[model samples]
Target chain A: MTDRLEAQFAFLNEADRLKSVLRATTLCDASRPENSGEHSWHLALYALVLADQAGPGVNIDRVIRMLLLHDLVEIDVGDVPIHSQNGTAHGSAETQAAEARAAERIFGLLPGDLRDDLRALWEEFEAAETPDAVFAKSLDRVQPVMQNLACGGGTWATYDVTFDQLESRVGVKIARGAPRLWDWVRCKVRPWFG
Target chain B: MTDRLEAQFAFLNEADRLKSVLRATTLCDASRPENSGEHSWHLALYALVLADQAGPGVNIDRVIRMLLLHDLVEIDVGDVPIHSQNGTAHGSAETQAAEARAAERIFGLLPGDLRDDLRALWEEFEAAETPDAVFAKSLDRVQPVMQNLACGGGTWATYDVTFDQLESRVGVKIARGAPRLWDWVRCKVRPWFG
Candidate 1:
């Protein structure tokens, strides 16, 4: 019993390293440099709050699971911002490959059934198929927008984000998944543009 | 335009700081050292995957919203673990007061309507009176169990958890909110005790 307890502690110690990795990643909302963990939380919220806004018959639970585990790979691969077109152009493939390896190791700490369940959820999220994945992706895009708006143009100005670019990257997702929120964004941005 | 952008960025910056605070305070698995951000993310997933398991007629979206914002206050008050009862005994009132202040300053970054909308969500989560809160709290408890089980008894062994204590903490909530998962947990733990 004592040995089992010690082994569990050792696994948790390793999981702590993953937290550090996530803390290093930043999001589109520069005001709130998101750790990977926080990003998961926000995405989960998106799955819930916007579940109704998704297409009819979408499964909210699957979307939530995807959001939570999608970035677990980031623990090893390191975070690559979805918007950083250039960031991915270089060593992203290698980074992602490494991340997959790490994810397997980290998740393997769990009992077998759970390990499979989480790994499957992670894959489902990456595939972004079915209603759940689509909704999860939509939330991923929207969370940063809230951060950006809250932070007063956050990375937009720092990164020299043009109106068109912002719309293309973030607006398009909102339009599809949560039209009401997207409409709200359009109204909000009009005055700024003028 | 520049002024509005500046204001927005300022808010994002504060939000970023809050994320940092949360990351520092909470453990990932309750037993493992997880950042508050990750904890939030995990709970969000719990809401999603466990949506069908939630009480009938409960709005999954609202539950998700509650889970996401539930810990935003931790940005100000810092995370107080469920088991760290002593850390919170004297500090909760002070923490609650501080969190309210932080929520105002942080959520205030967005335009009035958005700010109010988010602030209200956070408030509802704190109150935990509605179906959303009950289910949200259930998810909050469940995620740590999944993490602990994944990490091989995580804090359970570290805290010297007895089977009864663990069951009491998790069983009631799961039984009420997610009977199927609770049943699964019972099955999983039976062998451990034997």
Candidate 2:
């Protein structure tokens, strides 16, 4: 029992590094770029506030869990912005390989059952195939777009993001599980890009 | 549908204020005092990482949801640290009233259903009655103790906290739902206090 508790604490202590792992998107207040830890929290709040718009059969409870766990890998690889490297690294095989290894090393800090449970959730999120994972991914994409829109094209202007890129990279994934939210984002995004 | 989506976005945008709401506890690295946003995120992560310690009948999914929503009232009332104001405001009647009003206004930013759903989760956390709420509240108290332990008595040194105060104010609550965690904390905390 002591060993189990110590292992759990070790995993959590490692997670603290997430606070120092900054993301590219600026806060809505435009104060500073948000850290991965807070961004994941905001995304969980998005899961709660916007669960109504999730794809049918999405278990919002599970969706919320996925959002909280999804970004833990960024603690190891740092964030690869969707537009960086022409967004190639965003889903490249190499990046995926690095993240999978990070998952093992980090989640491996816990005892067997927990490591498996958390790693499985992380894997499910990466797959983005289940209804819950689909909705989780949709929110993951939509949040940055909303943050950009709020701060007057926050990262969009930073990356000189174009409408075509937004459509191909962000819009389609969000539309997969949350058509209504995607529609709203599209209307808001058009003015900024135009 | 458009109106509902807009309302959700408005609530989310308003929630951006949380990142600015600072708390007394510093980050584990002692870089700066942690803000309520990331603190809540850390607590949610704690819920995920330490779930094995939860009390019987504790539904960890709801516990995670409750933790995410718990401190949001801080966005309105600001954080009343457990050691501040003789710790009176931590759960004082006036504080409860202020937090209740804050809950209505903040959670109210969402449309009716989402608003009610989130507000109830927040209330469950405040009441701390059910097994899930009990475990959630245990984590809510334990995190700061762990943080203080990590950073060489982060807040305890600030407030000149005493062992009796730690026992009365913090330890009992954690033990209620997670006795094992309290046992672990007691050991680590003893060396500092002694």
Candidate 3:
């Protein structure tokens, strides 16, 4: 019992480091760069509040779970802003590899059953195959774009993220999850890169 | 179409403010004050990761929803800290009333159906009724105590919180949600207040 309790605490304590993993985009109010912890919370809220925007047969509860766990790996790999100078996901191949390893060490803090369950969920989001994953991935992409536009082109300006670049990176996944929102966002952000 | 998008954007923008509403508790890392947004995220993770601690038949999904939306009202009423100077919930009747009104206005930012759904969830948590709310409230009580212990009495030391006071306030609720955890935590934190 003592051993098991200690294991859970270890994971929760490690989660504190997430608040320090800064992203590229600033808060919409432009205070400072939002951390992964806060970003996940906002994304979960989007999952709840924007359930209507999701396609038919999408399971909102499952989508919320994916969003909550998605960027947790950022705690270990660290976050590379969507529009970093490199403009890559979690930085690059090296960081991606780091994230994969971090996912193990971090989620491994759980008991065996939970570790397996969460690792599968994390992989599900990465594959973006299921309806839930598609929706969660779309919300993940949607948040930074909103932050950029709300901050008057936050990361977009910093990274020189052009429309073509933006569309290629986020367009397909965003369309898959919520086509109408993807279309509307395109019109809203067209001038940022131009 | 624009109207719906506008409503969502407005709500999302408002949520950014939650990141600024810092709580009395420090991160287990003892870095800076943890903001309500990040704290809520941590709590949701607790809901998912610690669901086993909850009693049988408790809906983990519903509990997670309750945790996610719980502190959002603090954007309006602001946080009073579980172990604040007064060592009370929101400090005063006036403050509690303010939080109630805040819950309505904050959750009301969603489109009609979502607004009602979320407002109800927020209220359910406050009432602490049903299996889900009881389980959610338990996780809520559990996090801060763990934070204080991990930080070697972070906020507990500053506030000079005594064991009796802590027990009187949070003991029963914590026991109700996860009895084994509560029992372990009591032994873990007894030294802090003693």
Top candidate (DockQ) = 3
DockQ agreement of candidate 1 with the native complex: 0.24
Candidate 3's DockQ is: 0.76
The interface root-mean-square deviation of each model, in the order shown, is 6.7, 1.0, 1.0
Over B1-194, each residue of candidate 1 has an lDDT whose tens digit, in order, gives 33443444444445444355533223533543666666665566555445556787688767766666677666667776544542244236866788889788777875565568779988887776777777787777666675666556665665566777767766777666666667766676656555
lDDT of 3: 0.85
How displaced is residue A42 in candidate 1, in Å? 1.8
- Write candidate 2's Cα lDDT for A47-96 as tens digits: 98887787678898888888888888888899988998777878899899
Candidate 1 chain A minimal-lDDT segment of 10 residues: A1-10
Chain A TM-scores in order: 0.76, 0.98, 0.92
Tell me the whole-model lDDT of each prediction, alpha carbons only: 0.62, 0.88, 0.85
How close is every model to the real structure, measured as TM-score? 0.58, 0.97, 0.95
Using lDDT as the measure, what is the rank order of every candidate, best first? Answer: 2, 3, 1
lDDT of 1 by residue, A1-194 (tens): 33333333344344444455543235544433566766666566555444556788678766776776777666667776544652243236766578679778877765455567777877676666766776777777766666666546655655565777778767887777667667766666655544
Per residue, candidate 3 scores C-alpha lDDT tens digits across B31-108 of 889999999999998888888788988999999989988898889877887777557665478777898899778777
TM-score of predicted structure 3: 0.95
Please identify which of the two predictions, 1 or 3, would achieve the higher DockQ against the true structure: 3
Q: Candidate 3's error at B16, in angstroms?
A: 1.6
